[model samples]
Target: MSLFFKNYKPNTSIYNRQVLWRCNSTTATQNTEDEEEFRVLDILKKRDRQQKRVVRRIEVQPDRTTKMKPDQNWGNVWPGPRSFHPASVPLPLRQGYVPKGQAPPGKYANAELMKIPNFLHLTPPVIKTQCEAIKKFCTEWPKLLNSEEAIEKHYPVEIITSDYCHGSPSIRNPLARIVTLRIKLSSLNLDQHARDKFLRIVGDRYNETTDLVTLTADRCPVRKQNLDYVNYLLTASYHEAWTYEDWETEKTEQDMEYYNWDNNASKRSLVDWYLKVNNDDRSLTEEEYKAFDISVIPHGVEYKDAVYSLMNDGESDATIKNYATAVRKLLGLPVKVDRDV
Candidate 1:
């Protein structure tokens, strides 16, 4: 019985160690089980992490805009046309579309501020400074050309052009390439025939009211080319006006666009009629009539003017009335009353 009791004691010690190991494993697995419910304390711990946030420090720096001097060189700050920068610009500019009650957005980080055009760079002082810088390259204008008349005398051909400025991708404007040339008709050394022909050739381009001929050229791609084209057009028209055409000889006195009192058949008829009535012998030779002055007679000047207005300007009420008056004066008859001539 003593031998059996000693072997059972060693087996009991081994069984005790095995039972402790099993208890530890079961406790460790109890919290990780599928059936385990979450506690209130664990739920609070998860939510508390999201709630606890550190307060951030805002380090505000001083802006340097208040330090600008009244006479500061603005060209150095803004050299040319550019987008608006909030901190750089000193003015308190506001822009943007907002609700009727709401005010416009301020300059700070404003998209509207950048979109609006500002001429801050073109301030008077900046413009004066720029002009002074480039003044060394400019020469004094001639004293002789002080008056507009003197300028026109020396420069008969006045060429006009245009310039445009805007925020476009391309700097060129199509209308700016067009060139206009203007000159007084009297400025050209044209005779009576040439002047008449020039007026006819240019058509509506010549302003009879101002005696100014205007020519515009825009067919070319560039301004310089259009300028040259206008100049060429004026020269071609002037030269062509002076040259007589062979077909022009076919044009009769009646076919002439202009009327000349001295060169018409009416003047010869008047001379012959006067000589037949006044002279015992007709002294109406071509040389004698050519030497004779039409205005020497009593109402001959009035008659010539009436005939001139009738032929040049088509017959109007006033022209017909004037013609009848002059005819009555030449015949020494009393004036008619109350009826339209």
Candidate 2:
């Protein structure tokens, strides 16, 4: 080693640089090999941890409907209205809009079945059970009100409403909220003026033939509100009909709906003419004519009926003939005349 050292005449700068380079390369290579070994060990440790792990298993509960017997009382099971559930119902209900040829989808997870209202709660058995449960709360019908006429007479106002059931998402119907009230006009016990006013106020709502007045109110959103509104309308109209307006007293003969010989100018004219004929130039003055009673005359009743029938019923052949006959008889002429005059 001494002889080799002596023989090695070192190139000081170049030799030192080469030694430094080799040492750095060796240190880098060692560091790389250590990193690779740690990485491989970490991978093996992860694999070992995964293999040692245990997966948990959970027990599942079965559907309640699966245990239900076929003969079980359905009224008890479905007591009232509720949303549709697939697992709870046993029947194979199929529904859904699909292509024309393809069959309808099954009830399982079907949106169509869930969307619409169902009548499961209103089955015959359920209805009967419900009726029996509430039977004790209801009162017995009165024996006197046996017939429709009797019932109508006792209960004058009849309010009507409707309920609907259809294949719809919502059970509520717009038309069902509408209310109708019906009552006979005579039931109100109105006087002549009040009756005429009431008829006018009701207009087309009053049925002249049947003497029934119908009131309908549907502006409200609910049935109760509509019913109350209709009742209010009927009450208001009845009260208003009784209230006499100043303008109504001024209604003239031309404005009259029907002819009445008792209050008409024709009665005064007929009385004056009859008096003049009987007493020779002794005729009725305006004041005496106003106070005159047509019944004191012989042909007053016959003349009144004929004139009323003529004017009230229009100029028909029968009315004209009756009027002519009454006029001739009142003046002591033959009723059946040969000439046109």
Candidate 3:
């Protein structure tokens, strides 16, 4: 019985060791492939050394204190990974949050991480046909601009003017005309809302209230991870509104999902609705709520009813005024600047 137990234990231990060895082998293989791909990227970048672009330099240290010899011109090798892929790095590293003692890993773990630089620059991969046309335009620009027939044909989107300090009359003049002969989005499978936005950008319609771009409110920052999903396209000066009624309905639905219903299940009072709109996911405590001005501004086109309700409930006029100011600031409208005498 003793002999059988010893034999069984050794066999079980050997099997466990075999499994561990296999796992290590698989991981090593993956790491080697990753390194080889990095090497290939270095080679491709070296080929494009003459292209006008930004170059990154990475310093390597053998350890925490010992300095690795400076390899200033390592045959034009691209900076390994981190400098190339900021977003691919874990959120902690991207946000500059490192644990007390751990060294940060390189931002990008693989070649797929190359998409990050494109995201940061807001540049998409160029279409092959468009690239070919750009090449042709660059090579024969002078003749094309001078041709009366070509001028009459007219391109869709053209550079009306630019400060070209260095090149031929076609390129160097501040008023050199370069037009995009290619139409990009006409072929895209865009939704109606996006299509309308495109038209507005190209100035195809009247009464367009939308701006092509807007700076986000600093108080409510956009998610760093989701920024890659943002639309990065050429917008017309004015065409049409991007959001249709259906889109607004959908937006309302999303907002409702975050709202909390009371235990009583009574119709949510105006006070409750007002409070929800005024604050984000978090809420002020009862004391904080007491400090808030529940009053509405009578002068504004909307919310006069709410202000009157708060005042009727005995909220101070000074508190209401301060609340109005806070509301404006929250909405990203400019705050009135005060000068002290």
- The residue pairs found clashing in candidate 3 are 200-239, 201-235, 201-236, 201-237, 202-236, 295-307, 296-307
Q: On residues 1-341, what C-alpha lDDT tens digit does candidate 2 reach at each position?
A: 99999898867999999999999999999999988884345776678778555888898777658988988988777777787888778888999888999999987889888877788889888888789999999999899999998988889998888899776767789999999999999899797678877888889999878988999988999999999899889989889988977887898877877775666789777876777777757665767776787777888888889998887678998899888898888888976965775
What is the number of backbone collisions in each predicted candidate, taken in the order shown? 0, 0, 7
Identify the runs in model 1 with alpha carbons over 4 angstroms from their true place: 1-61, 115-117, 266-307, 316-341
Q: What TM-score would each prediction reach against the true structure?
A: 0.64, 0.62, 0.17
lDDT string for model 1 (21-124, tens) is 99999988985784676655776667977866799999976555677777778888888988998777777888988999998989898987776567888988
Off by over 4 Å in 2: 1-43, 51-70, 164-173, 250-252, 265-341
lDDT of 3: 0.42
Per-candidate Cα lDDT values, in order, are: 0.86, 0.84, 0.42
Using TM-score as the measure, which candidate wins?
1
State residue 23's C-alpha deviation in candidate 3, in Å.
99
Comparing candidate 1 with candidate 3, which one achieves the higher TM-score? 1
lDDT of 3 by residue, 27-122 (tens): 999998988884235767678786777888888643321332353322222223223443322223322335888764544454333433322222
Query: Considering lDDT, which of the candidate structures 1 and 3 is the better prediction for this target?
Result: 1
Model 1 global lDDT (CA atoms, 0 to 1):
0.86
